[model samples]
Target: MYIDSHVHTSFSGDSDTPPEKQIEQAISLGMPVLYITDHQDFDCPPGVPEFTFETEPYFRKLRELKEQFRDRIELRIGVELGLQTNIPTDLTAYASGHPFDFIIGSTHVCCGMDPYYPEFYENRPEEEAYRSYFEYELENIKAYDCFDVAGHLDYVVRYGPNKNTFYSYEKYKELFDEILKTLIAKGKGIECNTAGFKAGLNHPHPTEEILKRYRELGGEILTLGSDAHQTVHLAYHFSAIGDLLKSCGFRYYTVFKDRKPEFLPL
Candidate 1:
């Protein structure tokens, strides 16, 4: 099984799963290493549960758990920072200051709204909204070089009105290519998120074509993640995700330790 590189626990605003429970589940699945990547979305819109957490206790707990489970499984501390261009918070400082093994810079919000909510799609063509999302993603990484990998490269599709029914890499080839090239130029990676399957899409977050394009662009830092909020969702569809990566020309997937990429054979 591929190392589960993305996960969540009570430290995240949306997840309530205890950290220990997630670790136990990983052990039960015989996963040798698991990265606990809880969410930290600064500048969330009003009237929503802000996706921020207390870092002191968050690190304290994870450090303790890392030691407690060292023999059974390796636990890496990670954070999924929601990237935005206009937010006032110093994301670079926060990301660089943390003792993170992996950092996933993701775009959960576009134009000051999260697509997960229906209103993000209201009155806008699904294609337009999707383009805006990618535009923001490109802007974010270019403005901030603090993350190890871009989490869920095509996450906007998961909440699109058609939900990948009409989505294709060719439809937005220019933007996708720019995004891939920018990531490769910056030495950043992207995650193959399996949550798309759970979200009713036929493929993973980035889809097979995008993965192949990233490979073609000479981008090698790729990680596989379930984006799991609960134990049951951990390592979802490992066999299929692994096969898809190999088919897309990947013989290895990645894990992070001390924020450095380590490729493991697929």
Candidate 2:
């Protein structure tokens, strides 16, 4: 079975991709399963559109789409939550009450600022900034338990000074192992986000070494997501994901229905 577990449509503040267009594209690409994971970063930094969404409206729209395309495709509702030390209690409470099929808890902002800008790394050492990101990530996962999977474990590397070229899994091995152990103890998993390839990286997020390490630690719940924000990115690079997962020691990838995982053969 073919599916994309991470995608954002118009509902996400940063994306212009409409839900209908994503569905049409997925259908054309032979992917019958789709997850609409719009962003919701409560209390995000200024200078950008807020990541919050009107939940009622979002659910209503997805319900309509599910019914409209019921025969041709299977649709799932999900959200990409920007995890932080202080969990948004109101939003998390509301999310718990909803019928979302999946949740991808991710870290975008590190130490009160996004690492996307040069200023975030201006004077700070690269290793220091990257370490803070992981520390915050581990803290958030330990403090919050609402999500099914942790997304883009080494996302900060994507915006580093020299980018992934100067980065290595060995440098962050201890912290990464801690994060993996916590997730495994909590029964959570990580997504193999393919967005890095589209960003000109030679490999996917978290690196192949990280994936193999997760498997070696007895972790099993792994999901594949394109982390697509537009129609053209839907299932991007999915054609080779099977072999990639096999090489990483994963025989199955995961999907969720009603917030429960179902393993699909790689």
Candidate 3:
């Protein structure tokens, strides 16, 4: 059974896919498990309202889908929390009250800028930008303890301006190793986001070498996601990832329920 651990619906603010459409897409794709991890970044910049869990209609819709589709597919109510090290109280309060099946902690901001726009990296040195992004991610990972998994370990590389520039684990060995070690120490899984390939990067987020190193460091818990924003992107190229994971020594891909992880053989 295929499981898509990260996806966005209209609740994410940036996506247009409604909850029902997301469910229908999952069903059509033959994905047995779907986690609607609509983005919940609370401190969005000016003109961008924060996506709150308190949004009653969205949560209500999720509840409805969970019940309606329970027999057709295993629906998981999930959230992808955008992490900022400066606001632990806000993060804690937002997460504490939710009854989530999965929680994905992510760092979408780098050096006070969201890198979604091309202008974010306009004149900056690629290495400096990459380094700062990694540092910010590490900070977020350390600050948030309630999440089940760390989403897209090397997401920053996707928009590096200089696409196809190979970034090896050996190049950032110390920092990359620290990330894997921290995730293992904190008992959180790392998501193998396949969207990097769609983003013009040759490697997946965190790369195969990094995954191999993570396994070498005794990191076992791993999850997979397409980071799909559109229906056509669901489970995008996951079969290739299944082979990559097995080659990297990972025997299982994790699924979450009641915020607890369950291992499924690859």
lDDT of prediction 3:
0.82
Winning candidate number (TM-score): 1
For all candidates in order, the CA lDDT equals 0.92, 0.88, 0.82
Q: Whose TM-score is higher: candidate 1's or candidate 3's?
A: 1
TM-scores vs. true structure, each candidate: 0.98, 0.97, 0.94
**Which of candidates 1 and 2 reaches a greater lDDT?**
1
State the lDDT of candidate 2 residue by residue for 38-95, as single tens digits. 9988877776567879889999999999999999999999999888776445546755
- Which pairs of residues have clashing backbones in candidate 3? none
Instruction: Determine the backbone clash count of candidate 2.
Output: 0
The TM-score between candidate 1 and the true structure equals 0.98
Instruction: Give the per-residue lDDT digits (tens) of candidate 1, residues 1-266.
Output: 67999999988888899999999999988899989999999989886687999998899999999999999999999999999988889999999898899999999988888988888889979999999999988999899899999999899899888889999999999999999999999999999999998888979989999999999999999999999999999999886777788899999999999999998999
Higher-TM-score candidate among 2 and 3?
A: 2
Clash numbers, per candidate: 0, 0, 0
TM-score of 2: 0.97
